[model samples]
Target: MDLIEVLQHRYTAKAYNPDRRLPEEIVAQLMAALRFSPSSVNAQPWHFIVAGDEAGKARVAKGAAGPFAYNAPKILNASHVVLLCARTTLPPEHLQAVLDQEQADGRFAGEEAREGQRKTRAGYVALHEQAGDLGMWTQKQAYIALGFLLLAAGTLGVDATPMEGFDAEALDGAFGLTDKGLAPAVIVALGYHSDADFNAKLPKSRLADSVVFSRA
Candidate 1:
């Protein structure tokens, strides 16, 4: 299907068929889509924890307990659950690491270009840091990756539900994310929707273009 059709038909899956599993190849494609997601200054300030087994899914479901109980079954029964994490901090070492990888990937022409890239990216990072919104900036990048993952899943004929209903603190503790300078940003459930998924039958809704857009 075309991009427009995918956008028109894809809905947030409320329930999933536990008996169904996505093909391994499709999972790989989704992983790649996440890895290549665009972020400002190419910060890539995110990590994804993917749970594809019963034990793994149970662990991820910890975040969905208590007041977030409504979302528990979605994580437990889906073929896979992904906990999208954002870096809690962006240290100089992390920026250097990104620059090193870019150089290794032939992204620079020479030392001059490499240093230039480093300065440019660091300037943006510093700007956000000084504004006391560095953490928020990184989480925004993680959401960008989330959007890419959802779109990729739709194109691959897989169902996806991007959820923010989980408890971030609980999930961070469950995965030791805080110790690793990471924080849970969102959770996504992936699989085929089950018969109980009422959302599958609903028509997509959106505000009209006139209300949402204007000529500048």
Candidate 2:
């Protein structure tokens, strides 16, 4: 299907059919797509841990709970869950791959990627910058991951919900995410549909496009 059509038909799936499990290859493809999502200067910072087993999903659910998550059994009961991660340090393996792309795409103009570097160094260099800048930067990259994963899942017919109605601190502790030097930026539960968890469905409320534009 065309990208626009795929988007038009897609909805946030709050419920999932537990019996369905996405194929391993498809999951890999989805994540690979996320790796290429744009970020600040192609920092491309994000981590993904896909938990296909029930036990793992439950563990994550317990740690992260928000008011709307009640009755989200289909989400909790889905066959697979993905823990989207942000880290203090970028992984070496992931960095080298992007550097390879910069070499080919001219994003770096034959700079910084010449060596067989396993990782590229990136972060906010201005220590004096306000904390808000860092916060915005982190959230922006996280959302890029969300966007890519959601679209890829829709393309592959794996319905999912981008869940933030949860406790991040609790989740990080429960998952022992610190071991990997990462923490959850979001939780995306993926599976087929069941006849439960019908929520958040309504016409999207938005200001008119003109209201959001500056026509001076």
Candidate 3:
């Protein structure tokens, strides 16, 4: 596949055809792609909540009410919606969990490698904690996963809209995310674009290459 062609074809879909739904097999792969997205120090301090059913989507749509009402219909009409959340605090148990998963997945060569990995990750976590930036740092990492998912969706020929137009606290409450130590960072609505989506036909706009790229 021509990567540039895929990129050219992708855009922020304004509306989705509610009649269309992502196939379960494709959805499964997208989930896996999100799971494998990169994160700082392999902390992986994020949680992805998938909403494919009508009821579930409606619940998520609640966050878009009030000041965020403009986003409600997109959330409801999309075939699937994913809530990207970041850990409120990366406590010891959380870091340990990452280490444990790494070990279980045979990511370590031996005890020395495992210990080294743990120490490096711990130091970074400690730095963030000391600076009172743990939450912000984790939220930044969550966006990296968001970027990965967007590109992956484009490659898979799925239309996607990355959104930050909802009330984070409301979303957290609706999904009981804060109780799980996660805070809503962003949302993505995925599906096929509607035939009436005028944005699809508009030319893509970007800064001139010289203004965006530089060589040292």
lDDT score for candidate 2 against the true structure: 0.69
- lDDT string for model 2 (1-216, tens) is 998777766677767777777788987887787777777656666677777777778777775566646635755677677778876455556566667776777655344445523232433423313343544465568788889888988888777778777777777777787786676787887877677646435443558778999878
Q: Cα miss at 199, model 2 (Å)?
A: 5.5
Clashing pairs in 3: none
Candidate maximizing lDDT: 1
lDDT of 3 by residue, 137-199 (tens): 999999999988988899999999999999977887788887899889999999999988889
The residue pairs that clash in candidate 1, if any, are none
Candidate 2's TM-score? 0.74
Model 2: runs farther than 4 Å from truth?
65-72, 88-124, 127-132, 178-180, 197-216
Clashes of 2: 1
TM-scores, all models, native as reference: 0.98, 0.74, 0.97
Supply candidate 1's per-residue lDDT for 60: 95
Residue 159: error of model 2 in Å?
1.1
lDDT of 3 at 171: 82
Please give the lDDT score at residue 120 for candidate 1: 93
The positional error of residue 111 in candidate 2, measured at the CA in angstroms, is: 6.2
| TM-score winner, 1 or 2 | 1
